[model samples]
Target: MLAPPSASPRSVPGLRVPGPRTEPAPGRGARAAYWARLLPLLAALACATRLPSFRWPLWSPDEGYLAVQARMLADGGELYETVVDRKPPLVPWLYAGAFTLFGDDSLLPLKLLALAAQLLTAVLLVSLARRRWGDGAGRTAGVLYLLISVGLNPEDAQAATFEVFMLPCTAAAMWCADRRRWGAAGAAVACAFLAKQTGGAVLLPVGWLLWRGGAARRDTGRLACGLGLPVLAAALLTTPTGFLFWTVTGSGAYASFTGSELHVLVRGLINAALLAAACAGILPPVVRVLRIARTGAAELWLWLASSVAAVLLGFHFFGHYYLQLMPPLALLGAAALQILPRERTVRALVASGCACAVFLAWGLLAPRPELAHATRLAQAVRADTGPRDRVLFWGMHPETYWLADRPPASRYLTAGLLTNYSGGRDGPQVGEKYAVEGAWPVFRREMRRDPPAVVVDDSRGKPFAPDRVPSLRRILSVGYAPVARVEGAVVYVRVGR
Candidate 1:
């Protein structure tokens, strides 16, 4: 009887009932997979496009100064004691490490390291976007991030600045925070801070996310410990007076000379628009997140807010500062890309690729006015000076020291300190009196004790201002003779000494 019942309609061969149906794997479309694989290649190509710039003879003074300091460190000079600058130690330390691994004189290795950091940042952005949004968002975000980073306005984008070195750590911190890895996040944030003082701005958003994610009190404590330990170590290593004076008090004084707040804000907005145009896909996502106000959306908003704060902190809106805003904007842009139809998404991606190619081509072909003169100057200096010789640049240019492979006679790398000391056209009594009175004497004493073999003065073919540093003028007049002129710089060599 049981067998007869089993042979009924349910057991019929052609009319068998179906079991639970399995849905297709999400985002498994051929298009999604193609984009996912293409993202890294695009990012790598973007980085490779900048490689030829490594051989460029001209560089920003800041970059040149950093390179020399790093070389000094690699040559066994102590920080603060022998190498002094207003920047935190991490960047120089990174440079020192690079020099240790590669040749100290060549900029190629340092540039390669920067490119690697840039690529790592793009990868981290993809991981973060994917975890928070989806696969499509991740691929789009990664490609957009690369395009925007390299396509930033030319003013400060080409130089390997502090922001460039700090971005990977900042992106890593955000990725770790997204995953609820509080301790790792804290370490990453600390690394970012070590890279640049303004990098501490990341803490506000990261801390909020930790609290919102219901992290245990003990977990939060671990984060604090992780952050505090490196700071404490750095404090112990660097002299308190020097570190505090330069990074804190002196930094404030430096900020006063940047520019007017209104000027900075207007320039910053223009640069922001250029950045947005480079990756326009971010606009829709930004609008959508504002409308929905979900947790992920709120996190992105916090990131953008914090980035804005960081950019505006000094009221000095260098184009490089806008690099701080790129990660958040790229993520939002990627999300927007994800919302488009598949065909439209492919078209948009192809358009972005074309735009990036154009930007790269333009950057490569643009004329650098400093290149020919700088190369001549470096050649002249190298030809005249021996390996152990020290050179001093009396005016602003720092690139000479790096290019000629000569050590600085004094710790004041740029004329900025002297410029700030001597009241210029900016205003009366606006210069730092302490630097004029206090540091000037030290500079004079240093020059007297260890006078350079060569002194390059950049007064634009005119004598330097006497009021700026009368002692420097006296020293140059006493022992040096004008030897050669290159690129509006008067090169002086010791005559009788």
Candidate 2:
């Protein structure tokens, strides 16, 4: 068995820590028996915690937008051109695969994909912790991951967001780094990056470990080769200009600071508080790291720090961004608990379980304003239009498109292009400062080419009235008229249809 550096096992009476520093590996039968019991329990826990997601029609507009793009891709549309988003290609492709495998309307397949990723991440943490500490610590780490993963804001916790998918790859990279498998670590890092750009931060700690361990030249060379393979494959699958524009150039504008200092500060403070409250069960381990365990577990500390950088990468501080920190925190907390008395360990486990249960209940019972409105809008659209007809939503509600089973008329699904309304930021900025140049012209061109059968204005006139947009107003006046009002949204149908 392995243990924390320079720390001997304490002779605690009831604590179940590692026996010795360098024991022989466990027998294959013992390993199999351990997994045979643990895997089922972890699966059950994951299912129980994620139960609320299946009840929701949509988690958030982000996933809804991704689903819409995925649907378009399934119908032979190209990404970053015919259908565009600032996210990388892998997640969209995953969603597309889910749509293909289990009809576009079935969300169960997508939910299963996310659950598999979460479970795989927990299993990897178990393996890593078991190797470093002991079986008890390993089990604790896996359980803790499942518990805290759902102890978050409902949208983030229930939705299969990019963070949820990227975690397994991120944890795998860390596990490879711990085992000194530099090349495999690099490969896993690449996969994580393909899932989300924030995953690139995994390189920081991996590089630190490599240099600190004084790796051989061949090891570094192999790592570079592993990192390049997946990127090369991605390049072949996508147009260079399209990929760069959406993932880099377009994202740069989204990341730019547009809100007031006070507003940003307050949002950051609120998110910080939320993270603390949700993950409070793991606080003791964090405190231990800050006070005493830093030098002994420096790599874990580096991992935690790098994750913080990734979480705050775009400076948006959304709840899902905090998922990046959970893996390392779980491992560190498990290691800390390994030496604690049985009473303390039990107390921590109970607290984590309670947090998970409370959050799960809240997420299940919470009323999502967007989901209700989108459902109404979708019902109206379906009643008014055929299944094959194109519908355009002129607001932040991309979920309407997915819900109605209608294809979007433009690459820009939401009004972000026209309104310059960046989510997780302050307001719909004035004067189109943050808006993409030529996006409006593109939207106009697409509308002319496709000419949606129905157009839904869901903005509710808070930021701007649809009639206030001269181009849209002219188009509607020429060819369309309002047919129904569903909730606050006005549904319009083409004249003479």
Candidate 3:
């Protein structure tokens, strides 16, 4: 009788039986919706942290120097010839393009561009983490990245500097690698390198990933081609000699250690402290990665190690230099949060977010006497000079050139070359014993070719007074006289109009 009952359905021909219906858990659907909204919220947080930059006309010395260089480049000046800097060509050209679109003296557009890049970077981090972990981990990574990036000094975090621009490209390369798009990853790495030399460090992790993935011969060739394309384009646009020297050879001297042992030790200690403070926002998750989630963290650790090498390469340890560490740390931190209890994860993220807010507030409240002094000096220069008049700044306040809206009389934007005042080193006096070789002769030639209508001595006699330079004193005595003394700078004007 039992067999006959079973046969009723089993023996039926051309009949299909349906399985039990399955439904997605309510919690899963809610999480999906939460993650979808969380991404844009993270982007909004990024903009909120960077909003202060909108009010700042100038954010850092690097931005100021690059702005002047960008102006020159936009005005048809050649890199390393008509204008000079130790940075690669891409960032300056980017600035030139921005200036072309928005006009010069527009800091708003620059801030917006940097903010866009930051948001793109956060999105890319989300994609990378989500692929490896899950949606929750991805959101955590994005939030941590936004917070950790701005968790440093605003002078570095807010400025549209090379590091800021480089971050997106760096993050893109990692994401492309995770997807096994070797050629695109290589191109992204090259783009990052063009933004900043430190960006090249990404090649280590990317190359290792490619090798580990057992990429084919064509894949390797494609990557090689992608890496060479940007460099080739840059070389074609500018002279190969100029591009190589300024971006590579000339930068060598700048990167060399030029301080004594004690100075090195002191700077090392200070930078270590800075590194700790800069990383404190992500400490809990960083610890989690080191302790619990280490098995699958090899790639992230490699990424972090390479970034650390890049940040420590020049030994300068500028606040912005720490930005290179944020992406990998954020990804690792996200994995750490993935293994945590829901309550603890929320608390950790909240603590990290509050830390970022505190840093942003500090940056806003920090006194910027240098910027104030430059503003007063620029006002004085503008009042004393004509529309067509060219001005020369004797010190490192390159911002004055842009603020004054006057053309630079010489190719040297700042006198760091002539004065040998390497940043983060002992001071200008440390290298005074040795001349920069042909620096003075080149300065003399350039000045003779196009004499400035006004020369502002912004060097407040730290290493040497303005009169201490024999050539500068001679130039001032000949056709220039002190017209105004605003703040610590002395503005000299050409006599009798």
Candidate 4:
């Protein structure tokens, strides 16, 4: 035994001989560990880039309008009944929650919350990309999402709009569907719908996925239940009548004021194509996805199609409306990168990075005319009015109401009701006079019952037109006098109140 042990290692039941030491090969576990550490860092970086916009003044009137509604809700006001907006209740409620968690007065906290949602959406896109393709694709998808989302698209890129809020839920639904978790997918899609009514378009692809899977009937049933529950609960709480009338009927009226469908579609497609080309990284993936109709290819195509349909359906063609298309575009773009040679991919990524940098710089440095005007108006209003007093805007500027920290005199937040009544080229048809007249009585009643202390007439420096609504003009003449003029806005104070 001693002679044999001199040259050879002994093997025993419980012991083994050690050989030359070697490094362990990097496996899936190691890759997973690397991603686990990397994802958070990437997300933090993305969020950091948006810090400049935090204290930025209200640039979009829609955002300011939503903020006012949220503030009202936080102050124990009922949605739709007390504060009116045409959007679904969930967005206002979410804003209300943010205001409650932070203080209601400042917009910074709400902007921060929106930034958080943006980061989460980016992360979910990464995860979905990874599951569909691989780790490299996942990283690319997330980075692309961050770049495209924050680019200098103005209305969409800076504001806390419904499209910005709906992204995470949309991404989560796709991720869940990939995993065959039908119920979770349905629930996430429902959340998206709650965020924006157009988000219901996600159901088309999600339903297809459920139908193609095993246990189709049972899974479909689960999907339906998951999708229905929250909607049912929200409907019950809000009372379906008001919600339907506003979100559906009122929204139809709003859409009727949009550009012609042909013009809108052409403009939207051209703009979207230009945006995609500007980003550069997105086009290759879209091309690649189209060429290869793999197992999950149909789903991606469907998602893109549905998003386009949703955007065009509104007929508004606002830049933010195209935001619904970004997720699928990012995913397809990233996946396309995986098929390229290493050197070529590196070159492409570098080009994409440069483009993104340019866009980011533009977004951060660009001067916002609306924000500056809003700041001046807010300062003037704050100096003249008390917290208990109310202010009314006579034109389209709802941001003044928010910055001024004064409640609106009536439920008609925007001048849409008045503008619609006026019936210009882009306005409501001349035939809808009865409907427009019907809304005037309510506006008149509210304004007369609780008159505003300061009436800020923002009709481009013009005085209120006595001919359109003589009653309002009569009240303003009898009760108020010009106190301050800021920018093009003229502020009036109640006389001897």
Candidate 5:
């Protein structure tokens, strides 16, 4: 995570606590006031770190799905029926609720909520790490979290911010387990699970804690009731449609765990390794921050990386999918912050790591200048689009939907320009098989249907193909004609004739 840029004076004299080793404090009361002021300061800093230039960094195509689902829910779909997917009702449900309450999601209020939640996430991680380690470690870990966390785009961050709220509850419960608050910990674990699948992983961490602490089975059982039962209840109550979606449709899209594809495993491991190398580079600074967990920080790396491997290799490898691993990495980094030696070598390593992290993140995340033309065309569509117009795009740029202020539904997925919606039974293997078949006739028929379609496409990345371009051509050839070409992006109008 990126360290929220500090607006407060840097290196304040009496406020800087250097872990348990520092004995230069004047009085406990003064220190208490110091800390009291500091917490809000950190909170403000965290909020600011995430709030930079929030005019929309870059929108992912998937964001439209979220926007669409949220819009549908706000329009008054009930419970399970409201959310389109079965993965979990938590995030989409939250978006729906937010949209319903606000009535319009385009304004500042929704943006503020996302920003607030992200800041809260940073603060919570710092507090939990501090409780386990010390001020020094927490501060260091907090900075690292701030650094790495900035890697995600504003929209991506906003989409997953719901889980940030749940992470702290789980972390707090685990922190409690360190003190033998078994029942409380169990309940916390359950709550997190109810929040997201990552929450379910808390059970592993907590169960490990129970075994490590030598707690009795009866105690563990009590904790599970408090923590786990509600998750099960939430799952059951929200079943039927949500569950059915998962079993039938969602499985086709998700199932990362059961995925037999070779890249599934490779991608997961590569992501984990990148994370591991990242943590190792920052270990020295983190060691100086938290003195309490001096020995355990290394162990944390293993557990954290293992968890990342589990998630990355599982249902999907979407960049935001790595979020669950962030908290632990932050904690370990915080613990390491308390024990750094002031040697030149250590400082140099930390600085180098910081530089590498920034560059890598920039390369991975920086806006492709090429996307500008596509965005410009999106502006055109936004201006010309009539109220009833359902804008359709058949290109790499799905985010254009959000910028165009259109309801997301069929806007992003121009698949119909390329396939048959009424084609198959939606079995587990159907989507892959269909794509493999790479037939264009299905799409021609879909485009030929009632609503009429406006298709947008560009071939910058491949100009030929990246994810699937052979198909890109077939669609480009039959149903679409070039309407506008900005930079490298070509917007085509789908004339069903």
Candidate 6:
């Protein structure tokens, strides 16, 4: 959460009698237009930081695979039926719909969507900052958010772009709710939920508004309707059979996924550190302190605390997850920036922010080349591997299932080498528990229950001793035989016809 703003004095409701108007300030309109023009250019310039091919291949193997899945879905097929993972349909639906409409799943549409959201978040930040603080603070906030990469990471390509698009809507709506503009608020909340499930969290602050007297009855109803309609749309979108792709399946786990401690630890450590630092930016206070703080602004402390809480829920600490609260948090940061007492402080913060931005850009783009190389694997598998093959990895998808632009059932593998997949031959590496407690047995049950044509794993990292019997190695050694081997990876085909 951005450090909470000190509260403002509550004003008694009143309607002032009409007063005489005064002449406009000398340079007001001109100055406003100049900023308006500069804002767009600055936003457009931000686009350069994210152009396709700029970073090449640093994408996680999973997201890249999603691109491939999106292509398959566009070609007319049930999703997850082929892709074999548990994730909401919104993203795939989004990717497939746009790809189908535009005729490509290139990074362009993703970038474009992210660009629009990024720009909107900036505009909303500018508006909110100006209203809450002053023009100086507003411009400063907008510029900082723009010039820095706190919310925007080119490395992730467009994974968290949903935050950009939906966040502004949520922020604007929350601001409107705070101002008693039910219509605007309703529209904003409704749009955010449609964009991402986590976005519905915006309702938390808006709900606080209702509790805190920030919203009127009419505004509340409008907000309900706005949020309700999108849900109705989703209900309409989901089919009876299309129910398995939830991020968390019916049980308390990641529906039926498993992965190694190494994979989990590597990703988790990096994400946790980043999120911890981001959270550090928001000074923590006890509930009583937040309630009593004279946060010279409206619900500043409350909102900041609430905003941070919003991000932490279901927070895997992924760098992109921070985008959920970043835009609004930017407003808080802007608010925080204004209260800076010294020029030296501002310079220090700004410089540090710039350095972080560079690191973020690298974090995002640096992996692009590796991700791009994984595409080669996809191509090789398609060309050499038989139709009855699945490309498995003891690790993350080199790019993403969707990125391969291939079919869902393409057997583009992601199961862990240590997992109990394929008669327990392939399972998460030896002692890994990251996804097992949540994902394993479900996947094992699925594989033992369903069974793909073959079991293939990269097995690139440290080898795991199969403590479980009926392992793939034993089964394959006795029955299935290795048909192909690439790098440190191996593809095992079930032995006899």
Of the candidates shown, which would achieve the greatest TM-score relative to the real structure? 2
Please report, in order, the local distance difference test score of every candidate based on alpha carbons: 0.69, 0.80, 0.77, 0.71, 0.53, 0.51
Higher-lDDT candidate among 2 and 4? 2
Per-residue CA lDDT of model 3 for 1-497, tens digit only, reads: 01222233223332222122255433877767866798679778988878767757988878888888888887779997778777788888888888888988777788898999999999999988876766677888888888877766678788998999999999999989888888898899999998988998998888888888897898888888888898889877888887777777765445666554466556556655654565565676566434533335677878889999998887666778888988998887776666555665687678777777777887777788888888888888888788778999887779888888888998878766665565544453434333344567777887888789998888886553556667778888987888777777788888776
TM of each candidate vs. truth: 0.84, 0.92, 0.88, 0.85, 0.67, 0.72
Q: What TM-score does model 6 achieve against the real structure?
A: 0.72
Candidate number with greatest lDDT: 2
In candidate 5, what are the lDDT values of residues 1-497, reduced to their tens digit?
22233422124322233334445534679657646866676666555545542435433445444565666566555545434433456656666667677764453554566556555556656666665555655555555665555444333443434455556655666566766788788777766655565666666666667787676888877776777566567667767545545423443333424324454556556555555554555654444443332244433554475556546444445545666677776776555434444352245346634744553454455564534655687787676566556666555455566566664333214342232111112223323233312234444444455333555555454322324545456655765677776665666666643
In candidate 4, position 449 carries an lDDT of 92
Error of 4 at 85 (Å): 0.5
lDDT for residue 55 in candidate 3, whole number 0-100 = 56
Ranking by TM-score: 2, 3, 4, 1, 6, 5
Give the poorly placed runs of model 1, Cα more than 4 Å off: 1-43, 55-58, 257-270, 288-295, 340-344, 347-351, 421-438, 461-467
After superposition of all CA atoms, the RMSD between model 1 and the true structure is: 10.2
Task: For candidate 1, list the clashing residue pairs, or say none.
Answer: 282-333
* Candidate 1: tens digits of C-alpha lDDT, residues 1-497: 01222233333322222222254435658546665686669656656655544646434666787888887777777776667777677888887887788877677777777787788888888887766555666777777777767556553566676888888888888888888888888888888888887777778778888989787998899789878788667756877677666666675544664434465567778877766666654464446433432223556667778888998776666777888888877776665455444554576567666666765665677776665566678788889889888888766567777877888888777665655522122333233352422566777788889888998776563223433556667877889998898877788898764
RMSD per candidate (Å) reads: 10.2, 3.2, 10.2, 11.3, 8.9, 7.2
Which portions of model 2 miss their true places by more than 4 Å?
1-20, 260-264, 424-433, 467-470
Task: Sort the candidates on lDDT, descending order.
Answer: 2, 3, 4, 1, 5, 6
Candidate 6, residue 111: Cα displacement in angstroms equals 2.0
Model 5 poorest 10 in a row by lDDT: 416-425
